[model samples]
Target: MSPWVADIEAAVDSVLQAYHRPGLPGVSVGVLAQGEVRLRKGYGLADIAGRRPNAPDVPMRIASLSKQFLVTVVLMLEAEGALSIDDDVHRYLPDLPDYGTPVTLRDLMSNQSGVRDFLELRLLCGGNFSDPATADESYALVKSASRLNFRPGTAFAYSNSGFMLLTLIVERLEGRSLESVLQSRLLSPLGMTQTHLARSDIPWLAQRAVPYVVENGCAARGEWSIPLDGAGGMISSIDDLLKWARYVADPASPHAAHFRRMARARPYADGTDSPYGLGFTVMPYRGLDSFGHHGQLPGVFAEIAWFPQIDAALVLLANTTEINPFHLGRRLADALFPAALAPRFPPEVVPPGHYYDPGENRVLRVLRQPDGENYLDSAMTRAPVEWHQAGRFRPYWPMLHLQLAAQDDALVGHDGPRAVAYRRLPTGYAGAPERFTGTFYLPGLESLWRISLHDGQLTLALTGRFGTRHFHLTPLTDEVLIATPAQAPDGHYRPTLRITGAHGQRRLMITTDRTSRLVAGEMLPSTDR
Candidate 1:
């Protein structure tokens, strides 16, 4: 064993030890260097009441981490010339309504299809993830409510519905169940015997690491029964994940050629580049290239990050819903390799303007701080950013780098790939105040919004997870307005809100990038007396 192994082990232990509270669910972690397993361990409990101790070989749901397999199957079809990534998805699955432009296979795979996420859409529609549906049922739901957030390939919005379409495509092309294809093509060849894609019609495994959700104190078993075979459903162990991570970095693997092809960093139509590829996110963190994916559902959270440049991989599979594998994966990397961990974003020089990205029908504004700094504003979050050369920018704090649209002068780019595209707005725009004073509700989200006109300005309040958040609305145009969260006094959360109405009926739509891409939602008048 290397002498540095002790330091790495201790660092990882410090982080996991904190999660090892008595009666709470725990996690399984694996560390591999140069495609070799250096450390594999379990912390806390896999089943608290049954008293079954967690281990590296215990199987747990991998959630969206399963997307790579679906991506692989689709790429195989592409390789065989049966289908091309650029082909119109209507060629394979015509059930999906055409929202003007045809969404291509590449668009679906890369999250630029403008398709709304199936899971969140369900939630927005007064449904939860607990109820499982058949693949056909899931497809019909998205197609029935068929609408694209934006035109295909214009902006980036992660959509599970897009993957679900890919799932149908793969099955139709291969003429076999996705399970059989996954087993024969990727898993079997790689010798990953433990991993399997779970389906709705037939259950695969029996006993595995039990999943949990916290109650008042003790952890209790929880379930997320959403139809997830293509988008999120996956079951594997740490041992299996260790091999999968090694495979993720191995260019010699069966799908290495396809892997490299899919991993190519995507530059959006707006000239902004992001870390997301076909199914993987290829990012530069502290001077190293990290290839990884994170998956989450109720009662499960899984994440695996492979630094191909360093030949290092970090994985975390937790049965508990509260454990955020993405955050933990980053921390694990920091602990194992402490070199070059310092952050160097949110630069000192700030750009100030309202960038209008009509491609996605959104606005991104950066305002000057009294402290001489600049911050990005939105309804969701308010974070500081710094200007970089050649139309690029780096967010100092959140580890985001952006490539702006092709511009003559301004340093412009998305903080990361698939971010909003911004064109510097021209000078001189008018104001409209009385048009928006009303109560609106987004039925799908089960959330409410109130806009009021006071003293020729608009004040908006939204009931969110963090209670009601308030923002002062400034009109960019008669139809569009900018609302920066008052909580972020420094100006990081700038959400562009657009209102459309006719005959006393109105709709308010939000097009900001965050955990989920929100679009084309109704804003109904409040009946509250």
Candidate 2:
């Protein structure tokens, strides 16, 4: 009967109703405070065509968010004197290739193990990991990568391959799968009966939400082709996620306090620090410390955020890959706790002296260049101007609908059967071309992204330990500009970057990089590098 409970309920309802469009098959939400679940809700139909309503108890794919649960299990074992995070992977999984560098459990959890991501490399090699038969082979493909990309703990890069290795470690040490460990140690005790690790065959899960995709600008089903199952392969309803939130918030819970050690940011072996905790991304939200994880797979978009200090958490799950769960969750959080959120921005009252650019222009002028002003460009390639002609999954699909599909690198728009090679050009402030040149370092990636400018317009290119990337930037002031993909074409995941710094060792903050990588690109001083 607490007054805050009513606010939480209304907030949840508002978020679901606003984002739960007809095309979206289903969604689940959970809100908790101080070990008490305030609300657990579901909306829309699970199997829309089949007329199966999405129920609060219907289990659905949870995806990468499952990493947190797996982390909890590892911590629990650590607590029970079963294993140590510092233990090297070779100690248990000796069958893994001897890559010279020893990868430890903490290295894997922090995503600093330097193991190449299996899914990325596989896709680059004409392989599909989601096919039921090929899923099993993903592990071996990743294990055979011959060498670690970097020394353990030197940098932070998300590696599904590493988490898969963690899952294997659990199986080897506990004599059971990660799913079994969760069921026995955490879920069973917490009474989360509705959650389950997804298998290829779950006929009884007929009531589960149907994931959707966007194809040729229409709604379709997301491809069930991902290879990492255990790392991102669980399904749960809002009721079950609520139970999870409570368990996480409960300080007295066996697994709760253990997170403190995992939560503390650690220095990587290469002298950089990681804001990521075991399976959880540690971030500062609204001036308070928060812990949570986001999941992405074929048909699911999920975010679970909790303020450990206040004991309040919000979770949002969508059955489509196109939906922005973070935006939806933030809305609900703001409504539930208005004191913690900023007021809504009014109409297009542009901030004084803001510049605007049209398709034809490519010039930029930086009005003010502070001593610490740094510059960075993300969209190095240009997207076709005609939005409709561009790839369907570019900007709109994942932004508005939560639809997931393959981003084919070789895909070229063809009217009949010919390839259309596309490229993007850079423009400067207010379309004024201001050229910039610098070397950028993405710490999490332990790679370099180079930028070159010509005639006031700029083209940003990335070449790293993994591969190459392209981005575009338009300057507004001597220091400000809006950054997005030059074109909304397929195959490229464009990120917006705002640069700030002096002549060297500049810092580039990615205003919007969904995966949270490339947040800040720092140019290490020549003396340091």
Candidate 3:
């Protein structure tokens, strides 16, 4: 092995040492250089009770990393003249509500379809991931959305609902199940015999790693009963994925044209390019050009990053929620190419406080850790910011290089092509929670929310598939409030409710990271109240 490769293998061991201990769920890591596998190994146990150690061949749920293969299937169909990326989505799935604009397959591929994410919609309806759902049911859920987040192709918003629609399109064209189409067309040709889609209706392989939720040094099995589709429902081992990585990286491969097309960034309506391409996030890391995707389920976290400049790739799959594959992939990349990476500097100190963005009607909490690290908190996500120069920093979420610069009275930046500014709010700013106390109904979603104030704390309660869930509401501005689940299954959904209109005609506009433009009208006082 070369000196650098040896150094990287050692670094991998050091980075994964924490998860390599006893009674813990662990990760399966693979590294590739020049289209060759340099390191393929596993750390920790796959099943704690069985005492089975994770191995390179142990299949695990890759979650959304399944998108690349799905996208490839779509491209293959296009090549066969079965479909076209430019074709309107309604051409294949006419059941989708007309949003008064053409939403093409390309828009879905590049996450520009403006479709509301069905998972977020399900959460809004008080449904949990553990709730049982069928493909038809999920399809109906997606079709029930009466509106889009924005006009198609105008902006970029990550939506799994788009992929779900694509899956339907592929299935309708091929007249076969997505699983069968993927296996016969892609996996079989690549000789990936061990890799296959895991459907909710079928039993999974016994050799698959057991997913766990590790807390306080204890491991518990994670629950996921919802049906798996093209959105995120595939199982594979590190060995099989390395085969895929090598094939995609090869310049002379048959699918080279498709890979290139998939890597090209899609431009917005105004001509600014998006960081995301067809099912992949195309962006620069440190100083190297890279394209990859990250996947997360209840108990799974997976990352695949390919650096085209050096013909190197890194894959990390973990069967535990505690593991962060994205950050680990970066660490492995640093070890693999130390000289090529840009130098890091301390983050510019923007005073830790609540900053409100008037354009988006949201609040961002800038927090400083005791160890001097800085983080940006938006809705339910918290991402670490790495500062490269004075007053400028980048967040590590969404796989987008979202940069923000500290200004005199505001932090201004661009999220892809859209400009955003977050002005710092006064310290200890509080809103009158009672003003938002009322019952509201959203006609589009057929969901109702009751906002109540008890003992100086406000909460929003809604009932659906999983029964009633009460979310604690914290005021961001006098008119904006953030709602968080009061119990377990936390962090899955944090939506912001903004009050609009006058007293008698007041309404609540709900927005999440994925779905927006949902408004709920306040119901009149009934006899029950």
Candidate 4:
């Protein structure tokens, strides 16, 4: 190992050590500088039961990182004059309903198309990822969507449907498989021998790591699957990722101008700049402009980040769902270029103390870390405070703001212009919980999520694409109910529910924003079971 790489190696080792435990799935990391692999290493057990060790060269599912390849192909086709990003999607998929306005390819590429995420859409339709649904089936499911979450170009929403459509478009234009197009256009050109778009034909990939999930300190296979299409597809090794990320960082290379655009931010009709462009997220890490993509799927985790200013790229791939490699890349960057990163941190930070917001019934706990750093705790989540300016802190949730001044007796919490006061008080809520009893049917899901009023206790019994689950609702308001799960194995993350529709029709809707958007359903007879 060279002296230049030792620091990065140590930094990566620290991250690996944090995640590496006995019977845990493993990780692989690759660092690239100037088109060469500077460092590559793997840790933990790739297959704990099989006694196989993970290596940096092993390809794992890259998930959403595959979107970059779709974006690249689209840009390539555009450069070839075959199509334009501004072309309406309906032009390609003519049967696609034109909902008031045109949805352009650019909107899809930049995630301003407002397409409901395909995975979320599947669950919304009571479809399971583990089910063997073809790409055409997936397309039909997306096509059947009655309305987009929002109009294209007006808002930015992360979507998998847009990319799936793009992959289909790519295959349609080239009249060949997606794998073939990717190979001839990008992978072969970059000498990325270990990378491939996830394909069923190549089931037994060489040096491939078996995906695993950890539960109770033991490795186990997870019951999760995603279509190996444009959205959450592609299996790649760190070496291949390094080559690809390095390629993306170079604006003077193939599809150079488009590559530059991929790293830049575009705005919506509202003029709010979107942090995402093409397939990569454009953000500041330690005050340095960075372009990267984070991918997570059941039993698979990966992060690919390119620091264009430093002319370096970092790739982290893992076989487990538990680890997050996103910040490890930043750590490596900081370690390699300490002098470049030191100025980003504040010289001094505030001490641990309590800040209160009694109106909303929450207290802000500023707690000290083991390292003496202070963090903001809001009962539910603890987060490191990012100082946007002196005495001002941005809340992890965009809706809230915390500002403190050393001058006066109390630190004030502000919600916009209003001076919202905080106090320490025990809060409780009781509402009309029994009103929500009877079978509600979602046509999209084709299943009834029956809420039964069993002896004054409210319970929800529902069937998913894969299995059945139960929940008990805690009433928050007359129209709001919190559905807490009884038992687990469900990867679903629905937390809240709201009941409405008194005026026109008695309808049931999910008021809480979940990953999946289930259409409001009509109430069916109790005998409909």
**What digit string (tens of lDDT, one per residue) describes model 3 on residues 456-529?**
98898975544677889887677888788887764446777888777657898887667677888878877112
lDDT for each residue of candidate 2 in 199-255, tens digit (9 for 90 to 100): 454454666777765444355666665544567888887788888887777778666
Give lDDT tens digits, candidate 1, residues 264-301. 76777876665678887666666667777877665677
Alpha-carbon error at 229 in model 4, in Å?
0.7
Answer with 3 or 4, whichever has the higher lDDT.
Answer: 3
Q: What's model 2's lDDT at 141?
A: 65
Q: How close is candidate 2 to the true structure, as a TM-score?
A: 0.65
TM-score for all models, in order of appearance = 0.73, 0.65, 0.95, 0.81
Local distance difference test, each candidate: 0.69, 0.59, 0.82, 0.66
Candidate 2 lowest-lDDT run of ten: 396-405
Local distance difference test, candidate 3: 0.82
Question: Listing every candidate in turn, what is its Cα RMSD in Å to the true structure after a full C-alpha superposition?
Answer: 7.5, 13.4, 2.0, 5.8
**Cα deviation of 471 in candidate 4 (Å)?**
4.2
Model 3 clashing-pair count: 0
**Model 4 lDDT tens row, 1-529:** 3224446678667657766666677788887877778789888777777777778777778888888888988998998999999999988988775566888898988887866666655654445556566666667667766566667765555777888889888989999989899999998989999887874424666467877777767777754545568776788888788777777776677677887888887676766566678887775666667777878776777888877766777888888866545645566666676555435435245545544442333345566689875666543234555554456554332212344433243445453323555432223455566677766766654556778887778988776453456777766555555565666423434444556766224566552221224445656464475
Cα deviation in Å at residue 128, candidate 4?
2.9
Ten-residue region with minimum lDDT total, candidate 3: 1-10
